[model samples]
Target chain A: MRRITILGLTVLVTAAVLVAAPLLGLETIDPRQVAGGAGAGPEARIFWSLRVPRVMLGFLAGAALSVGGLTFQALFRNALATPYTLGVSSGAALGATLAIRLGAAFSLLGIPAVSLAAFAGALLAVALVYGLARARQGCSANIMLLAGVAVNFSFASLILLVHYTSDAAASFNILRWLMGRLDTVGPDEALRLLPLVAVGGFVALALHRELNLMSVDEELAVSRGVDVDRYRVILFVTTSVMVGGVVAACGPIGFVGMMVPHVCRLLIGPDHRWLGPMSLLAGGAFLVACDVLARLLAAPAELPVGVLTSLLGGPFFLWLLVGRRGAACSA
Target chain B: MDANRTLTPVLDLRHLRLELDGRSILDDVSLAVREGEHLAIVGPNGAGKTCLLKCVNRILRGWRGMISVNGVSIAAFSQRELGRLVAYVPQVGGRLTPFTARETVLMARYPHLTPFAAPGLRDQRYAEDALALTGIGALADRSLDTLSGGERQKVYLAAALAQDARLLLLDEPATFLDPRHRDDFRRVLRTVNRRKGVTVVEVTHDLNCAVLDADRIFALKDGRAAFCGPPEQFMVREVMHRVFDRAFLTVNHPTTGQPVILPEVGGP
Candidate 1:
């Protein structure tokens, strides 16, 4: 009953935000004009084409990041773990840098060349991490985590190398992309991301029970009949696809995945059934609201949503770490 | 002997050898447990008692020899199939977990539930029944992190019981229990073994508890069974002294006539 109430409240908030988000952007959107009557003017175009897609993109990217973050955290059994923590973002950055360096101008199947390149890069990083971890007997969480850290550092240097070789304009583009941005996505990009996030979210919800068991104890999970190794691989692959999609769409928005799941867990107990969907809804709402604040706070200037989120999430993460010493030690 | 004596043994392990990092963790050990029999294994800290239990459950796989469950080779059974046939209770030392006692117990139904299906009413009922059997039904809603050590141990036992498996492999089940809870655990074990006809293989450090509970006793020394027989046979002072490397005094229970042993304080 309490879980239902929490879920209901979260859905209500998400719905409210979804309706109100388009109204808060720089241009005033007349709802009557958007409702489609005579004299609709420029409001209809701005509402439909610009604000709606941007907000949709924000929600989609946030949901994907949070869901992927939750999955990775549960798999690794570490709260500090996130989709971006293991070089996915850096990989995407590298891919985007390559695209900029090559002067790529063509879009592939509706997705921009840069996003396509970023997605490919994210998948490559996941493959590299998975391969390195699997090469050692079992893909133990510790080994995978260490491998991810190593990949992250190597990818960072590779990004720097790409910057060194590329011209000044390409280097600036790469650095801006690395800071993470959530605006400027089109309806086509949002459409491309929707199906992937939907499938990934569905799979995650379906396996939430297994995640619950695995999080507590991996050996115990196996003894209770979870195909631990098989499930781990499935989860890793699923999270990679989801993270890749999000990064490709929004230049690797930071902290949504790491922050949202932990917040949702605190709200509803760690039952992933509740945590999974709740985190997604809360995450989408969170990013949209943050984007709104970023717009309002700077007015014409507009702070990057990623920058605002990181500013908030970094401290919350520290508080979480410091407040729960026991979890910190064990996790 | 009963009519079921003609049936296959519930558990059969033959020449099982496990080498970890080139060290012989288990060396050519063989044993069999009959249907519904309660067997207790007692040994020192490094006597491979836990390792042997792990072998039976296939948790630590890649053993050199064969393990059969009810006349079927373990290799033939999938992990889920084996899980339905056997439940394991590991020795957890009051670790804080994010699951409620009921939720933890319901996890036993994982092997029974189809992948992507939530636990149905039937599973919840069975979990509740197990909690009742362990006398922890009232505490089922409590988080495992908040439960007392004894209560937590009972929750683990309840979870194992909820599996409803034919065989149970317990490692130091009473390690965290107080005297009353220990008795409660023994009673629960008796109910499961006798009433439900479940086979049990328990690793315990408490010799007295074993004598009071188990139908048969298996003593291990350095990964090898030093003694395997009825509790009466295990009560022999010379065999007890030899297995534990200490002198022991034997006493029969006043009411049940079961043999109990106590190690002498000054024994070499």
Candidate 2:
């Protein structure tokens, strides 16, 4: 009951912030001018075309990736597991790099081309990990973790290889994309990506009870009528779709996926019914706050949201590890 | 008891074979536990006793065998159906967080509860009844992690009892308890078997406890049933020595007239 109330308040506060953000006079341009029939001057165009879309994308991507992380964490029973842990981010990066290399001819389909490629890449990465892990007897957690690490490193090296070989201007563009910037997206992109994120998140939330049983113990889960392989496959595909959608819109933003779920679990306990949705909301709120800070910290020249998340999350992660260490030793 | 009524076998294992890493853990084991029967599996460590228990409860799968409950093969039944028929209590260890004793018992009804629905009146009534039966009613609201070993064991037993299963498979249910608590647990088991007609299959190393309440005893040795019959068969020194690989002098108690095995000094 307390968890429900806390989550309810969180949702209300988030909705309020999303509603009140434009009214706060924090943005460089006026949202009213963009919405009204008044001509879209440079400020109105910037507000409508860039800032609004970017903030909305930030919210969607944050929620999608963090929810994906929560699913993976529950599926694998590992706190370190995330959307990026299985090489999906690197796969999406590779796809974007490939699209950029294709040049002006690919611009006809605009952002959809990159998103499609990213979806395919993320699916491919998951397939690879699944195949590797399934080859072992009974699908051990250690084997899955090893496969994830191997696939991530291989894809990351390929992405670096693509970066090094590309032309100077293309290299710069790819570098900026890799550094995780949301400035380039327009409203069209956010609308296009929202459905995939929403569908994936819904499917994940729908599997709450199954995920909760899985979280207890995998063997126990199987004994309780869960087809462990089938559930893992569904979770992998859904999380990949969500992560791919987010990575296609903005570059791979880490930390939100890895940290948000753990924090949500601590607050609401391990019941996935609460943990899953709470992580989604918390992720959005956290990223919005981070994005706001990113803009305000450097003013005109903004820092990458990824940099801020890492700077904050790295220490928090160490503290968590230390705490877990103390807990284990004491026990 | 009506002789005209057909009694359902709570657990039926036929030619069950379990192999792990090329070694047979349970080989061609077959047994039938009838309704209201209290069968105790007594064996040395690593004698496939726990493996047999796990197989019957469907915890460790991949065994080549026929395991049935109430004439339905385990493979044919859904896990929910199987769980409804059988409840397994593992050896107690570690703390399950956030779940109070009532909540833990409530988890036994997971198979019965509809998805996303809270426990109804029936479930609550059953939960209370189970707690009362296991003598953990006072600990219902207490966190399972905060309880003592014996108390936690009772909570776990209560959770299993709340499943309303006819077959209760317990692995070392009294290992963590003192002699008095152990006796209390045995008394509860006897009462539950007699009153509720719940079939109890327990694995224990304690010979005296098994001999006291068990209607039958099965002694396992090196992944095979060395001896299985009435309690009198297991009371023999030769049979005990063959199963346990230890020399023992059998003595008859003056008051109870039960045979007690004492370790033989300088005699094999």
Query: What local lDDT score does residue A171 receive in model 1, on the 0 to 100 scale?
Result: 78
Clash statistics: count for each candidate: 0, 0
Identify the runs in model 2 with alpha carbons over 4 angstroms from their true place: A22-49, A97-114, A222-230, A323-331, B4-7, B94-98, B137-150, B176-184, B253-257, B266-268
A116-226: candidate 1 lDDT, tens digit per residue: 999999988878887888888667888888888898898889888888998888878877777677676348768888898888888888898889888887877777877
lDDT (tens digit, per residue) of candidate 2 on A1-331: 5988979987997787565443332455555667752246766666666676776877888888889988988777777888788878888888877766655334446655665666667777877887888887666766887898899999889888888888998888778777776665467877877898888899889888678767655654554445566777788787887787788778788798988887777677666778888988888877877877887788777888888887888988887778855221111
User: DockQ of candidate 1?
Assistant: 0.56
Looking at candidate 1 chain A, the ten consecutive residues that score lowest on lDDT are: A322-331
Candidate 2 interface RMSD value: 3.8
Which pairs clash in the backbone of model 1? none
TM-score of each: 0.93, 0.88
Top model by TM-score, which number?
1
Q: Write down the lDDT of every candidate, Cα atoms only.
A: 0.85, 0.78
